[model samples]
Structure formats: structure tokens, C-alpha cells
Target chain A: MNIRIENLTKSYGDQKAVDSISFEVKTGEVLGFLGPNGAGKSTTMKMITHYLNIDAGNITIDGRSVRNTDMKKHIGYLPEHNPLYEDMPVIDYLRFVAELQGVDAVKLDDRVKDMVRLCGLNDEKHKKINELSKGYRQRVGLAQAMIHDPEILILDEPTTGLDPNQIVEIRELIRTLGNSKTVILSTHILPEVEATCDRILIINKGKIVADGTAETLRKTASGSQVLRVKIQAPSQDEVKESVSQLAGVALVEKVEGSENRLEIQSHVDQNVNEAIFRLCVDKNWVLTEMVPFETKLEDIFRDLTMN
Target chain B: MKTSNATWIIAKRELSAFFNSLVAYILLISFLGFTGFFTWLSGNGDVFFRKQADLKVFFMIANWTLFFFIPAVTMRLLAEEKRSGTIELLLTKNVSDRQMVLGKYLSAFLMVLIALAFTIPYYLSVSQLGNFDHGATLSGYLGLILLSSAYIGIGLFASSLTNNQIVAFLLALLLGICFQFIFGVLANGSTGWISELFNTLSLTSHFDSISRGVIDSKDVVYFLSITFLGIFLSEYIISKRK
Candidate 1:
């Protein structure tokens, strides 16, 4: 199902937990929610699930307002911290969630079996949730959220406590599910967004700061490019001076305590790679290494979220 | 899911949770032990002392035991869910706030029913000794069930108001004491409209009338309204986040 949120606002006493923020998630897309702690990502997801009422504006699922319709049946939610009934066995908990989601009696058993297989909980199905490891418990949380095969999945930090292999497996699973369902997952892992999400939304202080694919967000983050080069020249000072004088090269400085390394920063919309290569060849200096530094998502996130 | 179906599903899970933990067994054993002692073994209200075939002493002891027991059953219903953040998971399902409240209320009510069911042996033993007032005894059991419902309702309301089980228990008992005895005591000590109002509000007066084979609609309505108000207030508090 498609989700459209418009001018949604919420407050706690004098503080606005979620301002008039708006966004949309299309069907068959995975949107990664990125924000620092207390950035309102969870608040927005809660509002989408209708767990929290929108103080202002509204959310619509496939053109129907959530306030006017019981959209919960169509949306599967994994709350933050992934709370589960620790006293119940994993299988029983999954069945209970499926029943609460209104899975039909005739197919409930089949659905529960499917979730067990899908979430890789077959070995631990009979054990109580609290007896399992944190990674296994996380899998149980994911299993219950998808037990009824909901059209939309809203997961708050889905891979918080998983190992590397499990994280990769879950990302693959989410990617597969995204082909036929709308998935909105929030996380502190920067690479997880690029690995799983079709779009990235960065919100800060209850407002949206950036929205687009990872590539587009990086492209808009900065106007200039930086490159580090190691040249076998007579002197580091000579290399820095020559690189600084080259056209399109805005700044050049000798690498701190390095004998032959220099950092070159290019002007906006400029390419200094070819110019540096030619200068090296002309001056009889051997260019041993040159690496272009692309803007990292971490830097972009920090730049956008940090004041 | 249908409204009632969601409610039942939640209630079923809660019921199973109660059984899977030690709480249910502890409550049953203690409740039976306490009531069993005072009804047949105690010197004051024992069947031998009363010299009556009816279970009046049993009913009176049950009223007091259940007043304390219902809160224990209900204190963890909402408070634990809030503390562990499971309330968010449950509420986000295809269940409405009213369904959630009613489902929890049903679980505690069923618990009280189960506890009461275990006392049937005491009734059976008393009846075998002599001719029992079956009409009055039956109404007395009905009155106990209705009174337990009112206490469970109030207990659930108290549970919904906070995330601590201890606080919920204390608050439920505090609220329950007013109806259990304070109002009745005040009515006896006062006069005029104040006494009349306290008398009407006191739960013991209605329970007494029903246990005596006086099945008045006024008494039934009184118990039903208190239960409804408690359940209604719980729903209102839970949905207040909206």
C-alpha cells in the first residue's frame, strides 16, 4: 500500500516531538529513516502505524485517512526495543500475533510455519523468547511483524542486535519483501540504508532535512571534491607549491609529517586529476598513488543532523 | 478482525500468560487456603459455630478474600505491559482501545470465576450436612461474581493509570476500600442526605441485599454500573494519548 503523510505535527507539553513534517512511501519501495537520537524518526513511524494519534494534519493509506479507517490491519509494526512476551514460547508468540492481526483460522497454521521458515526461527520456535539470544529475539520480532503477510512493514531499528551474517540475511529478506510491499525501516547504521533502502530520508529536530536516494543526497552535500596524492618528488614543499598553482586546484597542502604526500582540493565543478597527472609527467615526478575522496553518507548525516 | 474477535484473541493470550506464570497457581492456592480456613476451620464463622446449612460464612469470607485477590490478578495486566513497552505492540494490532480494555477486563473476570469455582466443594459439603437455602445461596454466588467484576474493573483502571505494578496494586486497593467498607461505615455514622448518599454508593449494602435472596434490579444495576464506569475510565485513560 502507498502511504502519504501531510503536515503531521505532535507535541509533548511545550515541546514539539514531531513538527509539520510530510513524506510519502510508494508501493514496492524501501524507505530508510535516518536521524540521530530523539530526532522524531520513531515518532513518525508510530504515527504511521496509528499507535500515536497525529496532533495535527493526517496520514493516508492508499487515499484513505488513517483516522477514518482502521489501517492497522494493513500495516505490520515492530516497535522500538522489539518488546515481546518473554514468558511465551517463540511459536506461541508468533501465533498470538497472527491471530491478533486477524489471520484466518484455516490458513493460520500455514502462515505461522511460513514465518518460522522465513525468519529462520525453526530451531528456537519451542523455546521461550527470554531464553533466546538477543539476535534470535530480534528474529522473533521480525517474524511476528510479518506473520500475517501485511502489505506495509514499519520496523524501528530492525537490526539493532544482530550479528554481521544475520544483518546481511535480514537486509536481503527486507529487499525481497520490498519487491511486493512497502517497507519503512529506521536505523543508526549508515551503510544499511544504502544496502536496503530505495530512498533515504534524514530528519532532524522534528523536521525533514534531506530526502532522496543515497547518491543524490551525497551529490548535494558539498560543491567541491578532494583528492589525496603521493608523489615521489624531490621535496614535499615543491610538490605542494606546484599543485597549488595548477588551474582548477583551489588549495594544496603538504600531508602532515609526510615526506611526499599532498592533499589537493579542487574548485566547484572542476577536475584536477588530469591536471595533476600532466604536472607530474612534465616535472619528471612519479605519481605513485592518487585517490579521489567521495563524500561519505556518515558525513552527510552528521552535517544534516548536527547543529 | 471483528471487534469481539480481537477482544477474545487478546483475552486468550492474556489468560494463557496468567497460567504460564507462577501468579495463577499462587493466587489459587492462597485464595483457597484462606477461604477454606475461615469457612470450615475457623472458630468464629465456622459452619459448626453458625449451626447453619447455608454458606453465609463462606460468602462473607469470599467477599473479603476476592476484594484483595482481584487487584493482584489485574495489577499486572496493564502496568507490566506499559513497563516492558508491550502495550505499544498490542495496541498497534488490529485492536481498538475499547477492545484492549475489554479483553484485559475479561481475563481478570475469568480468573475470579476460576477461583470461585474451586469453592464449590465447600458448598457441596455444607448442603450434604442439612437442608440448604438453595435460592439464597445461588443469589449469593451471583452477588460475589458481580462484586468481583466491579473490583476487577476498578483494578484495571488503576493499572492503566501507571506503569508500576506495586502502584497499581496499592491504588486499586485504595479505590476498592472506599466501596468495600469506608462508605458503609460513614453511612452508619452519619444522617440525612449524606448518610443516604453513602448508603446508596456503598457496595456492601447491595451485596448484602442480593446475598439475602433479594434480587432487586437496583442492586444489579449498581454493580453493573460500577463495572462499566471502571472499564470506561480505563479505556478513556488508555486512549487519552490521541
Candidate 2:
């Protein structure tokens, strides 16, 4: 299913939680929603899943408004905290969710088994949810969300409490699910977005500040390339003088308190690495290290959100 | 699936949760124990002392017991879900707010029924001792069920108003007390139209009318209206929150 949100707005008292924002997610696409705390990421997901009413504008799944109950059947949501009945056994909880999702009684057993297997809850399936580790509990949450084979899944901070190993496990699970489903995952984890999302949307203060592939967002945020070169030479001034003269080099500066290090900034459209390498060889400066700096998603996120 | 099916599914889940938790056992034991002790063992009107085949004393004790017990059963129905954040999961399901409210309400009502069902042994033991007024017994059970239904509705509405279980319990109790006895007490002091209005609004008045083995349409309508009003207001609040 494809989701189209148009001019959506939600306000709590005098504060606007989600401003007039609009975006769309196509079928089989994994869209990552990134934002700081209280940036309306959860609010947007809630509106899409029809958990909260839209204050203004519209959200449609495959041309049907989200307010329609029929539309909810096709969308699955894991809320911010991944709430579950702690007293219920994992399988029982999954079955309960499946029943609510309208899974046929005849297929219920097989569907629940499939979810248990898919979410890697095979061992902990019989354990009460409260007794399971946080990682396993999150798996249960995921299982419930996908129990009915929803075409679209919306997960808010799905990896909030998981350890590194558990995070990777869930990331892989989400990636596998994304092959046949349209997945919208919201998280503050930059690596999760870079690892799983086909597209990224950075929302800050109820507005979309950046939207594109991770690479594109990074490039757009940092329009220029940076290179840090450390040379075993006589002085830093010599390295800066030679590198600064290159045609593509935008700026060159000496590393503070380091006579052997020079920082080079290059124009966005230029490949200055080769020029620097040639300059080092021609000037006979022993080049020890020349590393290109790629702007990370973290930098891009901070740049968009902090301002 | 049909909408009613969704409501039933939710109701089933809620009932299971109730039965599986410690609260269910605690409520059942304490309710049965308190009522049993009062009806069969305590006071001059105790069953053995009266030597009557009727359960008037039992019904009176039950009414008082349920005023507190029913709220305890219902306090966590919606409030705990809201506090634990499971309400989001519930509301986002393919179920409507009305279905959610009814599903939860029915679960609490069923629990009250089960508790009331346990008191049947009292009626049985009394019937064996002498000629029993079966009509009064039947009417008394109906009145208790209807009264419990009213409390369930009020409790559910209270639960929906807040996420704190204790607060919900107190709120429901306060509302139940007003409808149960306070209105009737006030009605006695007032006169004419005001007295009649208070009497009509008092839950005990309708309960008394039904307990007399005369199923008055006006009394039944009064209890049903209160039940509907409470459930309707709860649904309204849930929808407004969304």
C-alpha cells in the first residue's frame, strides 16, 4: 500500500506537535523517520495508523482516508514504547493480536507460528512477556505488529531499549520484511536508518528538514568535501602552500599545534585527491596518511535538528 | 471479521487477563467471604437466625459488597491499559471506540456475574431448609445484575477519565455512592418534584423496585438508562482523546 499525507497539522493547546507537513511512501519502500525528542515523529506515525485524529488536512492509504476503519486493517503500528500485556505469554499475546487483526480462525495457528518464527520468538514463545528480556519483548511487539501480514508497518523507536546484538537482529528482521512490505520506521539511531532504510526523512520541530536517500541527505548538508592529510615533512606551511595551489582545493589550513598535519577542503564537484597525491610526490614530501572525510548521517541530523 | 466479533475478541482477552491476574482471585475470595460471613454468620438477621427461605439479607449484603468490589474489578480495565500504554495498541486495532468500550464493559459485567453466581449456594442451602420464594430470589438476582451493570458502566467511565487505577477506583466509588444511597437520602429530606427527581435518579430506588419481584418497566428503564449513559459517556471520552 502507498501512503500519502497532505498538509497534516496537529496541535496540543498552544503548541503545534506536527506542523503542516506532507509526504508519501510508495509500496515496498522502507522510509526512515528521524527526529529529536518531541519533534512530532511519533505524532505523524500515530496519525498514519489512525491512532490519533488529524487536526487538519488528510492522510490516505491507497486513496482511502486513514480515518476509515478499512484502511487500518492494512496498516500495522508499533507505538513508541512497544507496549504489550506483560502478564500474557508471548504466543497468547501474538494470537490475541492476530485475532484483532482479523486473521481467520483456521489460519490463526499457522499465522501465529509464522510470526513467532519470523520474529525469532521460538524459544521465548511460551514465556510470559514480562519475564522475557527487553529484546525478546521487542520481538513480541514486532510479531504482533506483523501478525496479519499488513502491507504497511509503522514502528516508532522500535529499538529503543535493545542492546547492540539485539538491535542488529531487529534491523535484519526489518530489512527482510521490507522486501514484501512498505515499512516506515522512526528512530533516533542514525546507523539504523543508514543500514535499513531505502529513503530517509529528517523531521525537526514538526517540519521535514531533509528527505532523500541517506547519501543524498549527507551530500546536501555538507556540500563540500574535506580531507585530512598528515605528512612526515619538515613543516605544515610547506604542505599547505603546495595543496592550496591545486585548482580544485577550496581552502587549506594548518592543523593547530601540529606542524606535520594539514587540513584541506575541496569543492563539491572536484576530485582533489589525485592532485594532492601528485603534489606530494612532486614536492617529495613523505606522505604518511591521506584520509577523505565523508559527512556522516549524525552530522547531517545534528545540523538539521540543532538549528 | 464483523465489528461485534472484534468486540467479543477484545472481551475475551480482557476476561482472560482478569482471570489470570491476582486481582481476580483476591476479589472473588474477599467478595464471597465478606458476603457469606455477613449473610450466614453475622448479625441477628443472619440466615440461620431468620429461619426464612428467602435471601433478602444476602441480597442486601451483596449490594453493599458490590459497591466496592465492582469498582475494584473495573478500576484496571481501562486505566491500567492507558497507564501501561496498551490503549494505543487497542485503539489502533480495527475496532471502533464503541466496540472497545462495550468489550471492556462486558468483561467487567461478566466478572460480576461470576461473583454473583458463587452466592447461589446460599440460596440453595436456604431453599433446602424451607419453602423458598423463588420469584423474589429470581427478582433479587436480576436486580443485583442490573445494579452491577450500572456500577460497571460508571466504573468504566471513571477508568476512562484517568490513567491512575486508584483515582479511577475512588471516582467510581464516589459516583456509585451518590447514585446508590446519597440520592435516596437526599430524596427523603426534599419534597414534591425535587424529591421525585432525586428518587428517580437514585440507583437503590430502582434496585428496590426490581428486587420486590415486580419487574417494573420504569425501574428497568432507569437502570438501563444509567448503564447506557455511563457507557456512552465513556465512548465519547475515548473518541475525544483520539
Candidate 3:
């Protein structure tokens, strides 16, 4: 199901949680929602789910209003906190939610089995929710949210408390889900966005500050241009002389090297590489490689949020 | 999820949670034990209970029984959801506020009904005594069921108001007691419109009407109004939560 959020605004008294934010999630695509704590990420997800009524805005799912309860069949959600009944066993809990999501009774067992496997809860399938670790609990949350196999999954920080291994596992699962489902994943983990999201909506202080693919965001970032170079070990004078001679080299910085590395930046990607390669060869120094450095996701996030 | 489907799911889960835990059993045994013990022990003899088998015994005992017991049962309904952050989980599923309220209310009502059922032996045993008034006993139970439902709804509203179960329990009890007994007394001591309103607001007056085996439309209306109002507030409060 495709989701369209138009000028959605929610305010708590004088403080606005979601300030007229709007975006769309196409079918069979993953849209990463990035924001810091109190950036209204959870609030926005809540509004979309119709949990917290909109103070101002419109949300439609497949042309039907968000107010339509039947439209919920297309959406699944994993809340940030992963709240669950502590006394309940994993399978039982999923089964309960599955029935609620209107899964066919005859296929209930099969559905829950699929969910358990999909969420990697096979080891502790029968354990009480409170008995599991935070990561396992999160997995259960994901399993329940997706037990119905919804077309659109709205996951709120699906990997918040997991260890590295769990994070990777969940990321892979999310990526796999994205291939066949439309997912809007809200997270503070920027790398998760780059890893799993086809596109991103970065909100800051309740407003959509950036909306585009990773490449678009990187190109739009402040330090989007960088030069990756490998050069022969050189005398300090030669290095300083050749680096300074490049006309468009914004900054020449030595990458602490035992391995002939250098990091450079330029506002304009002119003939800087040619200049560096020529200087290395003219000095009879071995120039192994020279290429433009790709902008890191962290750099783009920092620049966007800071600005 | 379909709205009714979601509500039924929550209700079933809640119901199982109630029975699966020690709280339901504790509520049953304690409410039955205390009320039963008081009804029989207060009399001069075992065979006759304070001169009549009328539900004066049931009403009198239940009046205090609900004070402490209903809180224990209703405390965790919404407060647990709030504490565990499951309220967000429920909300994000697109289950409307009324569904949540009713789902939770139904579970608590069923649990209370279970607890109330244990008192059946009391009704049966009372019959063994002097010519027991089954009609009055049944009506007394009807009154209690109505009264307790209204109280439970209030408890649910209180539970919805905060994340602390203890706070919810106390607030519900305070509201229930104020509406049940204190409102009547206070209304009696005063005069005029304020008195009239408070008199109508009291739970005991309506309950007393039902306790007589005479179902008053006015009494039914009052109990139903409070139940609906409490649930409405519960829905509104939950809808406001983030």
C-alpha cells in the first residue's frame, strides 16, 4: 500500500511535535525516517497509524483516508519501546496479534510459524516475553507487527537496543522485507538508513529537512567532494610542494600512513587528480591510485542536522 | 487489523492474562471469603442471617468488598499497557480508542463476573436458611453487576489517566467511593440544585433501587450513563496519548 502524508501537523499546546510534515512511501519500497530524540519521529508514525489524532493534516492509504479502519489491514507497525505482556509466551503473543490483524484462522499456525522464523525467534519461541533479552523482545515485536504479512510496515526504531549481530540480522530482515513490501522505518541509526532504505526522510525539530536518495543527500551535503589518493612515500618538502601546487585542492591532509594514503578535498573536481598524478610521476614517485572520495552518510547527516 | 478484530484480540488476550495470573484467583477468594464471612459471622445464629435472607447482606458486604477488591482487579488494566509502553503498540495498530476501552472493560468485567460468581454459593446457602427471597437476591446481584461495571469503568478511566497501577487503583477507588456512598451522604446534608445533582450522581441510591428486585428505568439510566461517560472519558484520554 502506498502512503501519502500531506501537511501533517501535531502540536502539544504551544510546542509542535510534527510541524506540517509531509511525504510519501511508494509501494514495495523502504523509506527511512531519521531524526534525533524528540524530533517527532515517533509522533509522526503515531499520526500515520491514527493512534494520535492529527491536530492538522491529512493521511491517505491507497486513496482511502487514514481514518478508515479497514485500511489498517495494509499496514503493520513495530513501536520503539516494543511493549508486550511480560507473562505471555512469544508464540502465544504472536498468535493473539495475528488473530487481531484478521489472519485466517485456518492459517493462523502457519502464519505464526512464518513470523517466528522470519524474526529469528526460533530459539526462544516458547519463552515468556519478559524472560527474553532486549534484542529478543524487539524481534518478537517485529514478528507480531508483521505476522499478518501486511503490504506496508511502519517500524519505529526496529533496531534500537540490539547488539551488533542483532542489528545486522534485523537490517537483513528489513532489507528482505523491503524487496516485497513497502516499509517506512524510523530510526536514529544513520547507517541503517543507508543500508536498508531506498530513500530517506530526515526530520529535525518536527520538520522534514531532507527528502531524497542517499546520493542526492550526499551531493547536497556541505563536504560532498573528496579526493582519495595513494601516493609514493615522499619527503615533506616534495609532498607540501606538489599538494600546494594543485589549483583546486581545497585542503590537503595526510592520512596517517604506513600505507601511502592521502585525503584531499576540493570545492571543484577540476584537474586535481591529473595534477597530483603528474607531480608524483615527474618526481619519479610511485602513484598507486587517485580517485574521488565518496561522502560518508555520517557526514551528510551531521551537516544536515547541524544546518 | 480490522477494528472489531483488534478489539476482540485485545479482549481475549486480556482475559487470558487475567486467569493465567494469580491476581484473578486472589480477587475471587478474597472478595468471596471476606463478604461471605461478614454476612454469616455478623448474625447471632448460623441458620438465620440478621433476621432476613434479603440481600441487605449482599449489598452491605459488597459495598466494602468493592472498595478494596475492585481496585486490585482494575488497577492493571490500562496501567500495565502504559507501563510497558504497549499502549503505543495498541494505538499504532489502528485500534480506535473505544475498542481499546471496551476491550479492556470487557476483560475486567469478565474477571469481576468470575469473582462475583463465587458468591453464588452464598446465594444458594442463604436459600437453605429461612425462606430466602430469590427474586431480591437476583435483583441484588443485578444491582451489584451494574454497580461494579460502573465502578470498573471508572477504574478503567483512572487507569487510562496514569501509568502507575497503584495510582490508578487509588484514584478509581476514590472516584467510585465518592460516587457510591459519599455523594449520597453529602447530598443529603446539603439543599437545593447541588444537592439534587449529587443525589442523582450517587451509586448507592440507584443500587438501593435495584437491590429491592424492582428495576427502575431511572436507576438503569443512571448506571448506564456513568458507564458510558466513564468509557467516553477513557477513549478521549487514550486518544490524547502519544
Candidate 4:
């Protein structure tokens, strides 16, 4: 029903590919594993699936140790590569996976059929896998993983090679799947995590450094907000100086333009909007535009990881 | 689930690939052609063929025929999956390393059996012409099954070792031929533990005994060793790949 890891570490020689990191995903909960390249997201998924031996630590799935064969029965994993038997037909491939997961012969056909329908691969079910497009191939990979209806689904970079449209479709699929399955998915795309996950785990240097809802993390990570203001006056240097003197204004810099614009940076604990509006009115500086930058997940990710 | 179901699933896919592929057909036809030519050439000339069908001659020629084709057929078993990045999907699907290796091995091994079955017409023609050693013919086919399976196992192991199908093919060939011949040759020049070891490993010698219509326990063990060793190695390589 859930996954829990305690002080998990995986080292390749001296480098800790997956440093001591721990987090949990509740049943029917979607946890976005966010990280830049080499942050050990895939390594973490691999360790959880028992595909890679942990250098140190313990991991459990739904209260059962990941090492137990019983736990394997309840798990489904899609590796980042989307590797498959290209020479086989799509349906044949699914049936093979189903049998491996111990699906009974009587139910195997129905199981494969359900996956094919869910992944939208019905049209290409009989075609040779080698002939499918990248999107279709990814669909096949998804179908195979879900054919057994596992409780825990660990997907690593599921959208890496997909196009924009396919990315959206797959994202939609994951969201639906997440509603009924415990999902731990790793992706570097910031918007994707925001769109599909309930909670976010941001990993940096192989360790999870931040874990929270996307909105909450963005609130704290964006220590200061920038308001791009445009005024009617030819020169807004007077307005800029006035805004800089405001109580919450951290910095006020003039943007090069006869358009009368300034980029206002703010500090925590203060809203500088009131002071900026007062200054503009007092100076009779016609405020053409006042746009406050909303907190973006990309900004939060960069702030946490790129340091 | 019982392991055989997993094995059957893999075997079905593998066997379909074998039949669907031009390579399997090419190998089968070439095998029949070479063995047929050898059987014709030995007619009325070899002692056994003077009164009966030259099945020993047929099986002996089969050894050479498979050397070229079996490697080609089995090369892509595991190697292609690795190359195309499908091995990951296979493992996470609840298939153990043993099931994966055995399933593929069973698939390729079945191809050899089917191709051998196609050669039944030759036996029919021989029986109509004269009295053949019926027992030897049956055992010869049995020896071929064991020998080809051993080759398939070796090829599967080689395939698992690399993602490149060509590399797997070459590796399978080298190992297959080594098992079939080198141990026999090496056993000749030495007279000690080394000689005994090589003798025990000699594939052709065991196969040759079966060619003469005699099923020896040591020979059976020899063939089984090669088959199991190859399969075990395939599992070892695949497990590390994860």
C-alpha cells in the first residue's frame, strides 16, 4: 500500500550514486521524484524495486521488506529506458510479462486486454514491436508494467523520450493511474511534477533535500518576488529610486527602455505594491502595467538544485 | 506461478521469431541441403549405408551444418533485447533471471527440433530403399537433440553477455565449436587428470557414442553439463546487467 525507505544508500566505489535518502509514498498517492540529471532518481527507483542492492539501509513496501518475493508480487516498475523485446508483437510481449507475474491462463487475455485499452495501444496490439513509433513503444512499456495490476508502480523518467503531445497524454494516464495505485515517479520536468504529483521530493547530489507540496515549496524557495512595472513617463529613474526606498523593496533596477519600466525585487515579510503605487501616483508617473511574477516550479527547482 | 509457464511464454515468442524470421528458414534449408548431400555422397560407399540408411553420416553432417546456422539463430536471443533496451521491461515484469534465460533457450532449442523434424522425409526414403539400423536412427536423432540444445544454451549465454548481436554470434560460435571439438582433441595428447577432464567435456565424443546407437550415462551427463552450464552463465550475465 506504500513504500518506506530508511537511510538508503547505494555507492559505486567512493561515489554515492544514491546517498542516504528516505521518503514514503502512501497508497493511491502520487509522489513526484524531482531532480536534475545524476541526482540518483533512477538509482532510488532501482533500489526500491530490488533491482540494485543497497549499499546500506532498509526499504519496505506496504509493510513488507522489498527483498521478499511476496513484495515483488505487489509491485510494478517501468525502467527509464523503456526496453522491450522489439522482435515480438505487442500483444505477445504483454502476455509474456503477464505470465511472468504469475497471471493465470484464464485471466491473462482479459488482463492484457485491459492494459491495451488503458494505454491506448489497441490499434497496434498485433504489430511487431520493432515497427512502432517512440510514443507507441512507450505505450507498450506502460501496458506491460500495468498488465499485472500491481499495487505499487515505480516509473523512472517515463516521459523522457516522448513528444509534447504524447507527454501530455502520458501525464494524464499517470494521474489516473496514481488515483488507484501508489506511484513513485521520477522526472526532471518541473511542470510535469506540478501537474501530476500530490507531493514533491526534490533530490540534490543524491540526497533528498526538500519534500513538500509544489505550491508550498515554491512559496519558500522564491525568497523575493519580482514585479515588472511599466510606467508612461519616458524616464522612470525617479520612480525606481522611490521604489528602492520602500520598506520591503530589496532592490530596484531600471530596465533599459524608453518604455518607462523597472524590475522591482522584494524581500521576505513585506509587500511593496502599496509603496510602489503611492510613489507612481505622487510622481504622476502613469502606471501602464503592473505584473507580479507568480511563483514557478522551475524557479523553485533551480533554486534548490542548481546551487 | 510455475516456472514452466514463464518458460512457455518466452518460448512461444522465441519460436515464432524463429519461424517468422528468414534466418531460421535459411538455416533450416542449408542444414537439410548439407546433410542431404553428405548422405548421398556416402551412399553405397560407407559400410553402414551398403545395407541401411546412413543416419550416422546424416547426424555427423548435422554437426557441421548447425555450426553455421545455430549460432545465427541463437545470437539475438538475449543480445538483441539488451541492444534495443527491452531487457529492463522484461526483468521488472516479475520474471526471474532463470525464467528469462530458460524461456529464450527453450524457444531457440525448439527451433532445432522442428528443423530436425523436417528431415523425417529422408528417413522415410532410406527405409523404403533398404533395411536401416532403426535403433541407431532414433538415437541419432536423440543425440542431435541434446547436442543442438547444448549449442543453443551456449549461444544464449553468449547472447546475454553483450548487447551486440554480432558479438554474441561470434562468441556463441567460438564456444560452441570449442565444446564440440577442442576437448576431444585435447584429451588425445594428455594422460592424467587434465586428460580425464577434457574427455569428460568432449561433446563430439558423447554425441559420437549416441551416433553409434548407444546411450551412455557419462555421455548424457556430458551433454547435460554443457546445456546447464550455458544456461547458468546466461542467468549470471543477465542478473548483473540489472
Which candidate gets the maximum DockQ versus the true structure? 2
| 1 versus 2: better TM-score goes to | 1
What is candidate 4's local distance difference test score?
A: 0.82
- Ranking of all candidate structures by their DockQ, best first: 2, 1, 3, 4
* Candidate 3 residue runs with Cα over 4 Å from true position: A222-224, A228-230, A255-262, A288-292, B1-5, B42-55, B192-194
Candidate 1 local lDDT, residue B137: 91
Which stretches of model 4 miss by more than 4 angstroms? A231-235, A279-288, B41-49
Native contact recovery (fnat) for each candidate is: 0.87, 0.91, 0.71, 0.67
RMSD of 3: 2.6
Off by over 4 Å in 2: A256-259
Candidates, DockQ? 0.82, 0.86, 0.64, 0.54
Q: Write the per-residue lDDT of candidate 3 for residues A15-94, one digit (tens) a residue.
A: 99889988888887999998778999988887777677777889998888887766766788887777887899998988
Error of 1 at A211 (Å): 0.8
lDDT (tens digit, per residue) of candidate 3 on B1-242: 45576677788889899788888778788888877767777564333545776557667678679867877778898888988888777765646678888898888888878878877788887787687778878888988888888888788899989989999999998898798779999899999998998899888878877987889889988888888888899888887664
lDDT over C-alpha atoms for residue A54 of model 4: 69
The runs of at least 3 residues in candidate 1 whose Cα sits more than 4 Å from the true structure, single-residue gaps closed, are none
Lowest summed lDDT across 10 adjacent residues in model 1 chain B is found at B1-10
